[model samples]
Target: MQIDLLRRKIGLNFNDGFAEVWLWAPNANKVNICIQKTEHRLDMLAKEYGYWYLKTEQIRPFDAYSFELESNTDADNAKLKRADPASIYQHDGIFGDSTAFDLGRFEWTDQNWKPIAVKDYIIYEIHTGTFTPEGDFESVINKLDYLLELGITAIEIMPVSQFSGNRNWGYDGVFPFAVQNTYGGPQQLQKLVNACHNKGLAVILDVVYNHVGPEGNYFNDFGAYFTEKYNTPWGNAINFDDAYCDGVRTFFIENALMWFRDFHIDALRLDAVHAIKDFSPKHILAELKQHVDKLATENNRPYHLMVELDLNDNRYINSQQQGGYGMDAQWIDEFHHTLRVAAGQEKTGYYADFNGIEDLAKAYNDAYVYNGQYSEHRKKKFGVETENPGEQFIVFSQNHDHVGNRMLGERTSTLVSFEMLKVMAGAVLCAPYLPLIFMGEEWAETNPFQFFISHSDEELVEAVRKGRKAEFSAFHIEGEAPDPQDEATFNRSKLDWNKAATGMHKTMLAYYKTLIRLRKENAAFNDLNRKNTQARAITDKNTLFLTRSSEEQIIICLLNFSKNQQNLQLNLPGNMSILLNSATTEFGGPQPTANAIQHNGEISIAPESILIFSN
Candidate 1:
């Protein structure tokens, strides 16, 4: 099997009283393993297919080691020393040597855990470093019960790959296999996943396979792991279809499987797959899906692969038999952008292409607002219509990218009013697609999730600062951008959990709980068939009507985007009663009397509020 063959082809594999070490260095004349804190060295014999291998009894578990390579060509003659690209544990940070550890020893208690259906997922995205003051895997385990209480079915953690200085957003990670040492290393992460499964929560890990970080990157010295033929915003694209690309593909494929097979991850949210440049006969994503499907079949469990794609193409989520990549789901950023624009957010950058509620209504009808339509932002016709089901799309009002990429990283709570916050929450939960919420969003957190990085290289640090300031030029914000390299910036981004217990924050928490409960208990909300969904926007009244139905029940969500109260009377089919009202005093709005007065198809809706009704 390709899975078993790839697993044993690279890195250090420990057996009975001996260890087998393999490294893929197509351009190296010789390779040697240098033991940490000792003078011991082992020379590896070159085998076929440019693979260096050694079977010796000297290496043991937890043994720190580094690879020393001799150059084969005069173009690059300098001898190189670096950690394993597939290191499982980098205990002493990214710059330190790699450590060998046994993966089969962890006692997993999640053997009986079953996968949750995509239609029933209420995903909660979190950044482990900023989730709590402690900022580690063990700390995250302490909050699994809190998530359960909030009615969250899945927890999607930001990338935890080993990066420099332990303060990155995880996109700057250089090591693919190693878990961040500052996040309690591999064992603690395994414990957290195990604990989440025991508490009936699924875990989705974010992985970046488009490009590697700039700092501590030694791929250039090793082999052809990068290609100059394509460029990404981060830098050169990964060598997916270039020469000697088999190793690069296998390396990342192993990384994805390791998370599922070793760490027991339920899903993987692929970061920025649009940036992955590949022109091979079989795309890398399709190949990955094939491997994951086989693995899932062998284990008798379902493993999901989700992607973050800017392009509104359905080929990523379509089945392989239908000439697609076979992704389970994708992040629908258009829903968030259109919803924000309709809520009176500034129409700058990509938001300029959207025009209020009309675009939002379009997104409700079709998954993409720009399906083969001209976009002012891109100055071109973008996207194609797809017939994918609603459950294949994940929608959110606020996420890490939408909030953190801003000049000051202001969340929706700080950007909009309290009533509008309730409206936004209701808008997401009532949609046919899967819903996701960012950390601290339920209680309306005010802390800024600003961009921050901690790199030791002064040149790279300065470059990041300048690049951040330049990226914000389109938004035209006044004050200077936050210093990404500053330690204070990271400290200010931590969530203040204490705020959730007092004042409006407490009320907002209750409102979110109610919204989540309605989504779960109501058949109209839980059923994800888009065929039964209907949406209409009254532009003059600045109102939107979203009606969803199932065999058991039917519900309608009325949203008022204006800041003025509007009263209307319309003829309808059945007698409707209020299910939930955002304008009630319990949710920090006006008194209960300010709520809708429904009588004979006539009602009054408050400004910037949402009212859900059912028959």
Candidate 2:
């Protein structure tokens, strides 16, 4: 099978009391294994298909090693050498030597764990660098209990692949297989995933398969891994369908399988899948899904493959028999745009296409606003309407890109009032699509999630600082874009975990926890049947009404987006009682009167609040 043949014998593998090292250097005439921090040297014999192989008993676990190659096609063949392209762990830094680490042994406690369905998952997205004060893997493990108490079913950690320096957003990963050395390396990440599984929570890792980072990338030195034919937002695009593309496809496919077969993760959120340019008959995504589903069946576990795309295309989430990619779900960013504009955020760039109320309604009623319609922003006819179920779309109000892309990466609480914050949360928790909450959003953290990076190259650092400031000219707000290389920028983004116990922050946390509980335990909230849900907007009053029902019960959510109070007499259902009131005094608001006020079909909604009633 292709999955088994991908990662086999590519790196340092130990078997039968000997270390077998294999390297795929098609252009090299000679290869040598240099044991760093030691004086041992070994020569490799060239095998079929230009593969260099060597077996030695001198190597031990955690031994640092590198390769020395000689080839006339290489630019610096006699000058310097590169680290293993398939390194699973790196020591010192990304530029350091690869280590011989074994994945055969770990005290994993999640033997009977299985993943939850995509329609039932409440994924909480997180960035390890800014999630805690220490910015490491163990720190995140310390707070898994807090997530469990909040009724979260899964945790979607951002990328942790090895990057240059110490700080990054994980999109600029240089080493595809190696875990980030600074983030406690491979074993530490294993511990975190195992802990999450033991807590009855699934783990989804975000993987970047687009353009490689600018520095410390050496795949081009061996063969045609990149192409200059196509231009992306980043520089050269990866050569997925070009000459010698078989190896390139195998490289990324192996990376995806390693996370499932080796790391024991439940899912993978592929980053910027639109940037992955390919024209082959069997697309890389289709191949990946096929392999993953087979692996999941063999292991008797649940697994999903989700994608992030700007194309607004249904083919990514549709079934394979329909001539689609067969991905499990997609990150529907239009929900975030609609919610932001509805709550009065800046309307510039792509936000100009959305007008809040109508678009937000489209997001609930239909999966896309631009389906079979002309986009004024793109100045072209875009998107085809599809019968793809709403459960295949993942929606959120705020995420890393929506927040950190701003001049100041301010949270929604910084842009809107506390009551409106609850309003947005209600829209997501009670909607038909899957929901994901960014880290520090539950209690409305006051800190900003600004973009930050640490690069050793002085020239590259200056270019990034200049590029970020220039990119924000299209948005409102003045001044500089905050130097991403500055240590203070990263420091300002760390969450104040202690704030969840006091004042308004504490109240918001309680409100979120309550909403999550309803999503989990209540049948009216989580039934995936489309006929059970309906939404409408009262444009004149700036109010939205949503209903979700089961055979036994019915639930309604009312959200007011205006600053003035609204009193209305409307025909509601029978036997109504309050389930969650965002304006309650317990949640740091004015203690409203008795919540059951539907007598004679009359009720008054407070300004900027959310009221959920069940019948």
Candidate 3:
């Protein structure tokens, strides 16, 4: 069998300890290869094809190994010292050797675990680095008990792949298979997943398959892994449909499987799927879905593959039987836009297209603003009507990108009134789709989630700072952008765990706990079947009423967009009872008044408030 190595001219014979290492030297006639393992000389055997094979019987894990390729013709030949591309454990840095440890050494306690179905999922998207003060996967395990108590069924962690330097947001990952060495590596991640499962929480990892980081990317030396056929905002798009695309697709699929099989991750939240351009007969997304389904079936677990697409394309989440990409769910930006616009908040960028109560109603009912209609933002006809059920959409009041992309990374709580925040949370948790909460969103943490990275190159740091400032110019933000490379940027992003037990944070946490309890206990909230959902506009541009009902029970939700109180008339056939109210002081409301007002054919609504009535 012939296997092409990644880079350099290295050939190894499994039958012999001798391997041959070569370099293309058109001007030189003689060359020598020197192998060293942490100052120890190893016996090397010369083999054909200019390869030097060394005996590995004495080599153990974490052994630092490097080769010095010399040319006899030039006494001052430049030495080539490179880390193993297949290295599983990198302790000091990128310069390490491949460990031959067995992956099955760890004993997993989640053999009987099964993931919660997509319909029943309540995901919490968190960054492991900033989720806790400790900033590691093990620290996340220490916090899983809180998530379970808060009723989150799934934990969607941001990317944790290996990237340059010790710290980053993880989007600039260069090694797709290796876990970040700074984050305690593969064994630590496995422990976190097992801990989550033990607490009845599923783990979903966010993966970036659009483009690899510029630094530490060596795939080009091995094969044609990129092309100029397509481009994206980030850079030249990944070569998904060009020559050798099959190998690239397999690499990603295998990486996905590794997360599930090796680390026990229950699902994957594919980052920016729209940027993943592919024109193959079987789209890369479909191919990935097929493999994921097979793996799920074989393991007898509810494994899901969710997508983050800005195109508003419903085909991505539609059923596979209907000839659509078989994604379990997709992020619904419409929901966030509607709530933001209705609350009379930020109007920059995409939020410009969403305003007034009508848009909010449309987003809540149909889950899309375009729906085959003309879009003023794109200045073209966009988005197909989503035939998928509501559960196919993952709705959120705020996420990492929504807040972190801002000029100062201000959360929704910072922009809206305290009462409005509760109303937004009520709307989000009660919606038909699966809901997600950003890390500090539950308690309205005041700390900002700034964009931070640790790059070794000073030039790259300056360029990033300048780019961020330029990007914010369109929004008319004042002042200079914060330096992403600054240590303070990363330190500020860490969650102050002490806040969770005091003041507004405590109140917000209680509110979230109550909402979760209501959702779990009430049949009306838990029933995801679309037939039970019905929306009625109370005012063309100020208020809307959403009613979800199950057999012998009904939940009516009234949402007021106005900033002042308004008198609302109820025309229901049955008696009504107030189950939840965002206007209460318990949820940062003004004060507790009439908790339950009789139908009386009329009800008064506070400005920018939400009311949930059940009978």
Clash count list over all predictions: 0, 0, 10
Candidate 1 colliding pairs: none
Error of 2 at 291 (Å): 1.3
After best superposition, candidate 2 residue 8: deviation in angstroms?
4.6
lDDT of 1 at 600: 74
Candidate 3 residue 148 C-alpha distance from true site, Å: 1.7
Residues 64-109 of candidate 2: C-alpha lDDT, one tens digit per residue:
9988878887666672477888788987778898998776556788
Q: What is the lDDT for 302 in model 3?
A: 63
- Best candidate per lDDT, number? 1
Q: RMSD for each model, in Å, please?
A: 1.5, 1.9, 5.1
Candidate 3: C-alpha RMSD to true structure equals 5.1
Give a tens-digit lDDT track for model 1, residues 210-246. Answer: 9999899998777899999999998889999999898
Q: Give the Cα-based TM-score of candidate 3 against the true structure.
A: 0.88
Candidate lDDT scores, in order, read 0.89, 0.83, 0.74
Model 3 Cα lDDT, one tens digit per residue, 1-615 = 122212112222122332332222222233333334556554444444333445454444334454444434456765444443334445555545433323445689987676677778888999888998878888888888888888889899999887777668888877676678888887788888888887888889999888887666655543356778999877788888997665566667766776776678888999999999998988888988887787777777767888898988877887778878889889988888878887777677777777646777777677886788887778989888765788888889899998888878888888887777887888888887789999988988878888988878788888889888988876788897667888898888888888889988888899899888888888988887766787766664377789888897899998877787777777655667788887788777774963635456777888888888899
Show where candidate 3 strays beyond 4 Å.
Answer: 1-59, 64-87, 95-101, 593-599
TM-score per model over all chains: 0.98, 0.96, 0.88
Locate the minimum summed-lDDT window of 10 residues in model 3: 5-14
Candidate 1 C-alpha RMSD relative to the actual structure: 1.5
